[model samples]
Target: MKLLTCLKQIPDRDTRYEINAAGTGIKTSDLTFEISECDEYSLEESLKLREEHGGEVAILTLGPQRAEKSIRKGLAMGADRAILVRDDEGKVTTPHAVAKVLAEVLKEEEYDLILTGTQSDDWSYAQTGVLLAELLGLPHATIVMEIRADPAQKKVKALREMESGWFQWVELPMPAVLTIQAGISQIRYASLKGIMQAKKKEIRNVELSDLNVDLSSIPEIEVLKVYFPVVEKKAEILQGSTAEVVEQLVEKLKKEAKVL
Candidate 1:
């Protein structure tokens, strides 16, 4: 019944972002960070599963040193412990590289289930969880809205959300990975006592080198430039009698707008 949830730290949704001078990334100097919204749901799901099945819940995160704040918050929310893969150099940009690092850490551990957000807030790649599952050779389901675990039978049934308000049930054996969708469960707040106890919880930090992953070997999507989208506006008034105006509008739709 042991569960591992992957967490990520991202910029607050309300924060205004600016492209960096090199046009390669955003200027993060003044951005406020927090645990990603969907990841929070996954963490809450892990806590709920632990509560029902009587086992421990652990968090795994890969980010800069500042990410420890989010890990501590997860602990405060009821995670027993955490493993933080320090990436101060920011080398793990691609989803493949991230999955490789996480897979390396998971090699030494055993868990009945793994959870991750459907996608990250900043990049929205929506590929990390599936990639991690492939790397670990585990069965996985994405966009999961509900989970029913049978620890004794070593099987899990998940309800997956699909397009147009459709859902499908998927069953997988134990040691499976699931990409949790938001709104699957209500996230719990950290109580005062839990906050105090979180300070004493273990946060095992490891450098990227410790995992022996080579970032250069992984394929990456290059960002040639980052800029604000251009917006254009135009307006014209149709003047004439009702019949004339209708004709004019039709002509405009056929010629100027070309939408007819």
Candidate 2:
């Protein structure tokens, strides 16, 4: 029951964001970072599974040096160790590139299950997990609400979330991938003792070169620009009797707003 959970570091939602000078990305100089919301749930789920099944939980992430904070947080939350693929230049910006790098690191390792967030908080692309599964040639389920592993049978049963508040059960062989939905489990905070213990845990840091992954060869979705959305507000007062006002509102809906 070796569980590996992929975590991402993202800008804190409460931080103020500003578009960079090139208008191609956010200015991250002053931004605070944290573990992505759903990834925290994935980490918690991995920890729970390890606690129940008597195995080790590991964390894997690809990010800049600052991402070590998120990795340490996962270790403090009960992950046995971590692997950090340092991407200081941000070359691995696309989902395909990320999946490729992760798959490269995972090629030599074996795990009973791999977990990832349904989507990253910053990009919300929601493609990395599935792409990683494809790259690794493993069965995968997305938006998983629950997981039950039968290690003796080398299989896992997962409760998948569907549209309209529906759910479906899926069974897959061991060594599968699962994209965990947020709120699937309660995320536990790092206790003082856990934090101290995490200080002694191992964090193996590697670079893209170490994995022999060339990100430039990967196809990327181009982003032409990134800017704050324009917001405009206007108010018009309808004058006259109730019927006239209602008629004016209807006319505005059809002509001005065009939502009718």
Candidate 3:
């Protein structure tokens, strides 16, 4: 049971962010980075699987060289190895482009399962995992909360959550990707010894230029601008008795916002 988990590094969610003067992106100097929360859940799930089934867990991340910090954290948590697709200057790469790069690397590996977070924290697009599966021509399921593997039968059983308050049972073949849901399991802390050992573990850094992939030829989606969201605060104070306050609130919802 070999597993490939996609990890991403994003700004620390707790930090307040500001857009740059050009409004094309956030101010890099003020940004503090960390492993995305959902991706960490994916890594934890993969580590738990490997710990149970006695196989390898690999971290696949595409970002600048700094992204290795997140991968090393994964290694310390129990991943066997890490692969870095370094993009200097932290340039944006389209989901399709990422799928292409992953396809290039994954074509040579024989893995029983692949996993990814439900979505990236910063982008929250939630398209990469399913898109990669589509590009690789493998069947995949999103919002997976549980998985049961049967190596003897060479099949996997998964429970998927639907938005309509329903669950779906799916049986998928080996080498399928799954976008994992949060709250499925708890993430374990890496022991100090594991952290020390992770420093010695091999992390192969692969460049897009070296992969026979032509960026010039790959037509990626263009982002004209990225900006911080403007936030505004408003308060509606109902000054009256209890029932009158409730009535005012209802009127505000029906008339002012029209979203009851």
Candidate 4:
């Protein structure tokens, strides 16, 4: 009944971002980070499963040193411990590289289930979980909304959501991966007791080289540029009496905005 969850640290949603001078990435110096919102849902689901099945939940995260904050937050949310796959250089890698690293690390770990967010807010690639599953030769389901586990039987029923509110229920064998959707359950705040207990939780750091992964290796895809989206401006002011203003507005819409 042991469960593992993958957490990713992303920029805060409310943070005002600015494109870097090279147009290759955001100016991260002033940015605050938090666990991806969807990852929080996956963590909550993992905690809930552990609560019901009476086992441990361990978190796995890959990022720069600052990502330890997000890992600590997961521990405060009741994950028994955590493993941090560190990238000291803070070089942005592809989802494939990340999946490879996770697969390698997970090979030595013992777990009956693995969960990850449907997608990361920063990249929205939504490729890591399934890729990791493929690399590990494990079956997986994405957009998972619910799970019912039977540790004794070594099987779990997963409810997956499709387009237009449709859902598919699947029973997968033990050691399956699932990409969880957000809002599956309410995220709980860290209790004072849980916070204090988390201070003593183990956070084991594993460097990329220790996993036999090198940052200089080439990836399949290269990001040519990363810049802010172009901002379009549209505004109109109507003058004169109410009726005249209305007429002018309608005329302007028909002639200029083209939404008569």
Compute each candidate's TM-score over C-alphas: 0.88, 0.88, 0.86, 0.88
Provide the lowest-lDDT 10-residue window in model 1.
Answer: 228-237
* Model 3: per-residue Cα lDDT over 79-98, one tens digit each: 99998988886653777777
Candidate 2 per-residue lDDT, tens place, 1-260, comes to 89999999999977768988988989999888999998999999999998889898989999999999989999998999999999998978889999999999998777999999999889899999999999999999999999999999999999999999999999999899999999898899999999999999999998777787877789889888987778674678899999999999999999999999
Candidate 1 structure lDDT: 0.93
Model 4 lDDT vs. the true structure?
Answer: 0.91
Ranking 2 against 3 by TM-score, winner: 2
Clashes of each: 0, 0, 0, 0
Where does candidate 2 clash, by residue pair? Answer: none
Superior by lDDT: candidate 2 or candidate 3: 2
Candidate 4, residues 176-249: lDDT per residue as tens digits? 99999998999999998989999999999998877765546636677789976686746556779999999998
